[model samples]
Target: MSQHAVLDNNTHRDLRVRIEPNADLGDAIMSCVTVPAEFRQVQAHFPILFHKNQANGAFNAIALFGFENGENLFLEGGKWDALYRPLALSIQPFLIGRSADGDGPGQVHIDMDHARTGDANGVRLFDEGGQATPYLEDIASRLGLLDAGYRASEAFFAALRQHELLEPLTLEIELDDGAKRSLVGFHIIDEERLRALDAATLGELHEAGYLMPIFMALASLSHITELVARKNRREAHG
Candidate 1:
């Protein structure tokens, strides 16, 4: 349970949070989330996919880390397996929340009850003069980047939808129990359609700086092989 409060030095002095590097801190059921401007780095490890919120009909780009629900294969030995951890997962116990004043925009808030937060064993939040510590400053910077990245992605998402490059992906996998599972309804970049685009359209994407990230998203699809292999290995071990 999260009891988020606007982070303050006076109220949180002497507080220390033991950042868990190895543990899987992301949502257990839906391990995937939007990567925004971090797609270039995210694509190197996770498969980038286009997802639509059925309830709100919002389209966003996401980095897929596992095949089935609640199964993040990258999690092992009480830690994450990959070298590049997504920003969404790294900035734990902290998030962009609604401003208390309700005046301008969202502000940063921390889950006061998070397992990482305590009186000891983690980075300090503030100094004696009630100023942010170095650790806190770095966290603030990361959060800023994450917020800006998501905002910037809106335009890129629009370009993708306009060009009709997003297409649904379906997968057939046999689990360790000899049960065949069909992963469906998720979307991916349609490479064929992307390739078939005209020079003018290509120029537009290039001018808009959407070309590279699109290629990165396409490249990340290869990571699906790693997911399949992990599943096969799990079944064989069993």
Candidate 2:
């Protein structure tokens, strides 16, 4: 369970957190929720997919890291092997918290029980003068980016669904040893449908600032091939 509390310098002055990428720090994730605003960066490293929310019937964009659960191929030798790590993963053990009525600016909340928290040799969140450190400032900036991106993603997905651009994705992989794997219950943008969109509809999507992200998501599918290569390499070494 998570022990969440509003971050305060006076209450948690000596707190330090591990910021490195490692499985021990809960970095062994196969996928994470992403936003349309991050597609440009995320596309360069990972495959992007959409997942449907069964309860609300909404769609959430995701960045795929591995073929199996809890397998992050990008993590090796205590380092992330990518130029751009998703903002969602960079902000660890901390999340944006809203007020009781959920009608105000967000606050930074920390999960005290997380593996990244309470490390003796980790980065300090505040200075002796009770001012925020550079590390904490960076985290706050990332939290802002994530929160804004999350809100914008709603409209982006709404546009995709409105135009019927999403289609069920069926991905299958074969390893060097002849083992087979498959990804289920994920969706991808339908290129054919996108190409068939009328001029007026394309204009609508463009004006709404969602067209580039659509293409970015399509381009990101190429990274799936690279992920398979990484998996094969890991298996060979084992």
Best by TM-score: 2
Clash numbers, per candidate: 2, 0
Candidate 1: the clashing residue pairs are 17-122, 22-79
Question: Against the hidden reference, what TM-scores do the models get?
Answer: 0.87, 0.98
Looking at model 2, residue 135 earns an lDDT score of: 94
TM-score of 2: 0.98
Residue 185's lDDT within candidate 1 is 76
lDDT to native, each model: 0.78, 0.94
Q: Which sections of candidate 2 miss by over 4 Å?
A: none
Query: Mind giving the per-residue lDDT tens digits that candidate 1 earns over 31-51?
Result: 556555788889888888888
Q: For candidate 2, give the lDDT of residue 220.
A: 98
Candidate 2, residues 70-189, lDDT tens digits: the string is 999999889999998898899998999998887889999999999999999899999999899999999999999999999888888888988899999988889999999999999999
What does the lDDT read for residue 120 in candidate 2? 98
